[model samples]
Target: MDRPRRIAGEVWVAVGVLAMAGWTLTEPAHPAGFITWAAAILVALGTAAQAVTGSLRWWGGRLCGGVVGLELVGAVGDRFGAFGRPGSPAVSWGDWSHFQAEAAQLVPWDRLVVPAAVAATVAEVVLGVLLVVGPWQRWTGKATAGLFVIYLLAMIPGMGSASILEYGLPVLIGGALVSSARGDRRATHQSPAVGRENTLAADYK
Candidate 1:
């Protein structure tokens, strides 16, 4: 089950990278578009890092966590830089506000959208770090899963079917990561017992 989930996660990450490539090809020839392109690539890298390092937990966590940390930083930059609008001269609070406003339309929390977005951003950075340096696997994995679920839901509205489809693969990858996290933690817990059994068999031989 763990192997299958890891494989699926890898495939999903590859699909996400390809989808972002296609988006790059089709997007309007504008500078601001690069921000979205870069963000997608960073996310794909993080997903792939988690998928590939099935055995090396520490390094895997670092790779995945670092990329996500960078991603959150980029997102914060987008908020202030107006998502790098071509003509904007300074921080574009308007762009950030517009984004949360659209999300407000879908959920019944109009007043909470801004606060939620802010909290999510901060959570992303903190959780990403904890995933890297902490021993709390289940907790970090659950938090990451919750964050991606919010992202998936917020994406459904104001996007075309194709765009939505492109985004869906990442959600699947995130789910796979969550499963892998649990599986890995269990494996870690059982490894010492397995080692002891092997040692006993060798002694008997």
Candidate 2:
């Protein structure tokens, strides 16, 4: 992406982080929700930092990915009654069952909710670590792109317009990262070809 667009995307991501924080703070009783939002904020801030400073882009990408992985873990934990407190209605088997039904309606299959959720959550954590700490970043970017697609599709049926409004840009941002990473790989591959052509020209001269 061009510099201006990159900066704009970063700003949007930062704004989303702040918005999620503001929304979460209004419900102080929901600690699990707060934690998830905090992770999302970290991701947004990290990605924004990438746009702000080119030298730290790798760090920023890793930070965002790491936090996103945490968010996924928190989501999985929340599903299993891990976030419940004594007087709070945080854990509800009934609600979870209902959610399963909803998810089934959106994307129906055998063992849809548990299996899909578990798989996606695990993948998110793994991909996040790879993005942050591993050398295979282009693959990481592709994995992230696929994960975002799944998330967007899964949420849209239930969340409707609100989900789209909140998440659409993130999906776009993911796509941008995938495209840019792929472009970098292509450029790297072409370097040797360019070098060979340069040597051939020098010989002719």
Candidate 3:
């Protein structure tokens, strides 16, 4: 895609994600949440596909990374009551205690809850940052896929009623593809000599 079209696609995908996030915070269990989530995933899937198959691979990677990063940070914020008061209808897992209660259902051992929650929180922030400001997109993307897979498996006991699958599955697929795809060759392989020449020309001006 050309630069303008590529930018438009990225913005569209970002808006879709933000819409889903907003809807989720206000009405996580609402039936419409599924529709919005699915629609966003569809848009994301198309953009990601175009990126992988065309010259926009770098842009695609950043898009996926940004979405995932924002999701992680936002979820962490929700856990800490950043968006709303704990136990309020406007928020999900409105506080750390509330989040732990939800986590307790997925964790097998009582002893593991605190440690697991702590580890997961720390991982989310670190990985989220790395994904957004990536020096290693490929590895970070794979790690993100792994994290989502773990979450999916943890939800198996409630698979019959799970809402996570609506977004989780697509994210897993997107993360895998982002990990495997190559970045833009021209951007990665630009000559240092050419850059130095540009610097010299600017200096003389």
Candidate 4:
């Protein structure tokens, strides 16, 4: 990315991280809350570093990947009642049964709900790990994007009651991951060619 655009993106990311940090700190005191706040701070620092050095590809992939990975894993935690009871404000589904119930609302077949919920949970965990670890980003990013697209379509039935963040944010982040992956691929393809050209020019000089 160009310097101006890269700086602008970093600024926005930093602002987001700061906002998350602020929110996390304001939440009821809990060990997990502190951890989340710390993570947000780290991301903010990473964003600042990238802004100063203008290293978007390296930092950008990790930033986007880390944020998405945490979101997926944290969601799974919420479903498992890690944060609070199922019906509590902090919890989403709250347990396997609750998740299945929600799945039933979206799944056309009742028999498919259990398996679908299980598969989704497993996929989210695996994808979350892959994204956080930074291996196979191109394929993982593509997969994440596909997953979010599926989520957006599934939520159409409840769009009237759903918050914009519920249906929109994930899709936006997924698109960013896909775009970043493509940028990485292009950079990979051009590097060796650029290197070869530089070597030949030096030989002539």
Candidate 5:
């Protein structure tokens, strides 16, 4: 909630995401799993770089953009892999099988997964674009926070540990996003009270 604290939070979050993704990448799972892991790290790297370079100016926008772009790339991979032949490349980690199970049980899951993936991917792209250009920025941040929360919740009913972590990563990202967007830290940093003691001493002269 303060500038130093905000910086500290961002640093820890960046570290956590990189650490989680790095471990996953080394562990060797499905291609989908690897891609998701890879994407998380990639976004974290890009985000940290951008933050250091001052690309965001504000706190959250650039990081959100980084993840949105990363996930959009992931959406492409997921759509391609999900639509591929069932046995092709051995369909890593049973996601294909889970989709099959969901399809069989729900009848509409097949239809839903594809469409939901499409819509979410499209939304990510749109939000990314909005973030880059200024006017629509606030909406993009809110949308990302909302979607990340939903994804995290959705992971609960049956999403395995990996999937749960996958979703959790973004939820944390969104939390940072919300924190950055509100930017009470930045405001407090600039507030006179923050340095009023020093100012008061000078005034006595």
Candidate 6:
């Protein structure tokens, strides 16, 4: 955590989004919902500021680490009552089952999910490894950017504004790495090239 501020900001923003969702679900509570919503807004705003100012790259390692951490924590939570049972996840259990059933009805067994699921899962795991190991940040950055696009595609099929709000933000954030790449390139290109020392000639003589 080279930059503790960035990690705090990013984590806070994620939490803030959660808080906002919770607040909205229980709208117009006598008084306290307003406070929760306000706090959410502040956290997200702070994260955005840090992200845009180039002060949060320290969280690069944390970003990769977070991918695994969140998944581990989620898997563990679901094992208990924290996330409800297998057939029904606590939050959107009904919708989840409905979607699966609908997809099953429409898709044929032989022609269905195996290929895509395997390919995508493999890619995800490989990308996660690359991200964690810091093997090639450029390649990883580009891949992450592509994953962001894939997420947007996921949202598009749903045809919901809420989906866009919930998922598209990550795509925007992924663009941060792309932006960093371009900035690095520009800085490299602008620096004076090889041994061309053209100092002022003999003015003091």
Among these predictions, the greatest lDDT belongs to: 3
Candidate 3: tens digits of C-alpha lDDT, residues 36-124: 36545754764665465434664555565666666677678889999888866546678899888877877999999999889889988
lDDT of all predictions: 0.50, 0.49, 0.59, 0.56, 0.47, 0.39
lDDT of 5 by residue, 1-205 (tens): 2244335435645665755656557755632355555545545554454344232333443454555545544443443465355455433223444444532332335567656655655775675555444333334545655666565555655454455465435534543353333222233245556544432332112
Each prediction's TM-score versus the true structure: 0.58, 0.55, 0.66, 0.62, 0.50, 0.43
lDDT of 4 by residue, 1-205 (tens): 2344344445544544544444446643522334444444444554454444223545654676676677678878978888888777646678877877877877888788889888999999998887777666656756776776676577667443232232233323433343233233233335655744543332112
lDDT of 2 by residue, 1-205 (tens): 2234345446546655555455446645432343444555565656665654333554565565555444444445554556663234533222345445545655667667677755765785676555544445545555666666666676767556344333333623443352223222222234656744543332112
Q: After superposition, how far is residue 34 of candidate 4 from its true place, in Å?
A: 14
As a TM-score, model 3 comes out at 0.66
Error of 4 at 162 (Å): 2.0
lDDT of 1 by residue, 63-144 (tens): 5444444544554565655356634543223366654654565456667877877787688667656654544544555566
Clash total of candidate 3: 0
Candidate 5 lDDT (Cα, whole model)?
0.47
Clashing residue pairs in candidate 3, if any?
A: none
| Candidate 5 least-lDDT 10 residues | 196-205
The best candidate in terms of TM-score: 3
Alpha-carbon runs more than 4 Å astray in model 4: 1-54, 158-164, 175-205
Q: Rank the candidates by TM-score, best first.
A: 3, 4, 1, 2, 5, 6
Give per-model CA RMSD: 7.5, 8.4, 9.0, 8.1, 9.3, 11.8
How far out, in Å, is residue 204 in model 4?
35
**Model 1, residue 87: C-alpha shift (Å):** 6.0
TM-score of 1: 0.58
Instruction: Quote the lDDT for 74 in model 6.
Output: 36
